[model samples]
Target: MRLSELSRRSGVATATVKFYLREGLLPPGRRITATQAEYDERHLRRLRLVRALIQVGGVSVASAREVLAALDDDSLDQNERLGTAVCALPHGKPADADDPAMETARRRAEQLLELLDWGYDPATGATIPAYGMLVTAIAALERLGYPCTVADLEPYARTLGRLAVNDLDLVERYGGTADEQVEAAVALTVLYEPVLLALRRLAEAEESRRRFGRK
Candidate 1:
């Protein structure tokens, strides 16, 4: 199809499509003539991924480019590709080493992973955004006098591990091709986050009512 067809099919404007092409978020189509190019299904899939990254995921163009590059990198295996793509998009706040709880929380995070036997690359430990985020969260909880030790977090880690597997199962069940799978992963992860949180809150409310009914 031509650019107009791609734009119409994708529900994105021609100007936005051209902008993505220029920004390299979406790959260029095959040049049929000096001025015209023909796009295919791959382009449509890519446009969907690009739109999800920017509009839904709320990532900047540069970050979206990084995510797209990571997703399209042929050298990486499927797991690595997904991890790289996920990490490429922005996440986590910067660490503050000066905080008293930071070091303790960091140590607890590391120890908790070890206790759970969750394998992770120590080389990438410092670079993984989740590490810093976990540390920050634990540290904040510590200052607030909340229980955030390894024992306190172990059940969450276990449940979330199962949740991650379920997420992958859903992705494979619904998504067809590799590109489509990546698109599904991004879409589901971002869009379903609030659903998960709301479910958790509702569950807690139900449990609280069972334990402490105020009739």
Candidate 2:
């Protein structure tokens, strides 16, 4: 397909496609002439992935480029590729280590991981964002005067662990290529996070209605 055809088929503007090509987000199409290039299905797929990352997943172009590079590295195994993708994705900012709430949350997070037998090194960059999430949640609960014990949070942790396992399984089994698998992982989280939260809110409302008449 020519650039115009590629743009039309992919639903991305020709100018944007050219920008992606120049930014190295999309691979160059085959050269047919000094000024003409022909794109193929691969280019279309890549353009879709790029759009999903930037538009849906809120990933920056630089981060998307890094993820694409990682996916394209044939030397990386499946686990490494997935790890690279996760690390490349956006994460919550880490809280200062010296803060008392952060320290407590770190300890609680470590305890939870230990109880679950999930070995994670605190120094790993991949684990930092997760730690930040844990600490933030814990701090929020504490500030609200509804601090939860480890046991109280364990069920939710177990459920999320199961969901995570299922998500990874689906990506590995159905995603055709490494790049596709990474894209699926990012898309699943980015697109479905709000859906999951909304479902939980609906469930809470339903439960309240069941316990007390809706008003």
Best by lDDT: 1
**What's the distance in Å from true for residue 151, model 1?**
1.7
Alpha-carbon deviation at 66 in model 2, angstroms: 2.3
- How far off is model 2, as Cα RMSD? 2.5
Residue 22 lDDT (model 2): 98
lDDT of 1 by residue, 29-69 (tens): 99999999999998998888788777877889998888888
What overall lDDT goes with each candidate model? Answer: 0.84, 0.79
- In candidate 2, position 180 carries an lDDT of 75
The residue-by-residue lDDT of candidate 2 on 106-140, one tens digit each, is 67777887788776765773255656777777866
Per-candidate TM-score against the hidden true structure? 0.87, 0.85
Model 1: weakest 10-residue lDDT segment is 89-98
lDDT of 2: 0.79
lDDT for predicted candidate 1 compared with the true structure: 0.84
For candidate 1, the TM-score is: 0.87
